[model samples]
Target: MSSTTGSPSPDPLDGPLAAADLDALVDEWGDWAQVADLLDVPRTKVGTLLREHRLAAAVPRPGAGQRVPLAFVQDGEVVKGLPGILTVLHDGGYDDRECIAWLFTDLGLPGRPIDALRENRGSEAKRRAQAMAL
Candidate 1:
């Protein structure tokens, strides 16, 4: 498509690519049950966490369910800083999908936000999230 002046229209995929790239960060994402199993929690608790925004489903599966990014889990626990980061992002007016995208995207830190968190840089991640609200 072209604009009224005949300039080529921007690619529809351009904007979506940013969000879409989160899919590439992991070979596969997990469903709620998978996440609950990883965390050693009951499946119902996983639902509560998702509803409370303590955990997020970054992308939806093709058929019916949502997929949680693997980056958020470490050694069977949610990464130390993730819940707080999620809360900050949520307060900053980001939804679960946006929060996941932000975490996976490079934000000029040592690496992606999830990486920083994994490296025990939760404070830095939290700071960045706080900055987003400002």
Candidate 2:
């Protein structure tokens, strides 16, 4: 495991550790249902993306020329439930519609963040409230 002569490559998700750090993070990834809402994708599509991306385990380093078994927490979340999946995607900045489309045949949701945000935060009642306040 030497550099250019077989040195070990740096792990992308590596850094300072405080004893079982990876294990701890994996333990509290939270529910996929919340993640779906955060990602703005339907619950159904989560499984598809999991299987498609092979995201169940630690994602591999590109062209690292090594088999690094992932340090993933086994929450028994794959195929059956979309749990523990969306957190990774959403945290990685994949928006709702993108997450949905990647898993399903496109729910045809809005692609713009402003529109999406407005849809979530805006409403006729809210508009009226603003008007009245003014």
| Candidate with the greatest lDDT versus the true structure | 1
> Candidate 2's residue-wise lDDT over 1-134, tens digit each?
64476645332124211211222233223244544444456755545555554333221223422111121112332322222233444455543323322222211243221223224432332232233224
* Candidate 1 residue-wise lDDT at 65: 66
Model 1 C-alpha lDDT versus the unseen true structure: 0.76
Tens digit per residue, CA lDDT, model 1, 1-134: 84466544332234542345555555558888888999999989888988887788855445646788766778999888888999888887888877887777666787778899988977887998899756
Estimate candidate 2's alpha-carbon lDDT, on a 0 to 1 scale: 0.32
- For each candidate in turn, the TM-score is 0.79, 0.25
Tell me the whole-model lDDT of each prediction, alpha carbons only: 0.76, 0.32
Model 2 spans with C-alpha error above 4 angstroms: 1-22, 25-28, 57-134
Give lDDT: candidate 1, residue 8: 49
Which stretches of model 1 miss by more than 4 angstroms? 1-20
Model 2 clash pairs are 1-6, 1-7, 2-6, 2-7, 3-7, 39-96
Error of 1 at 104 (Å): 0.4
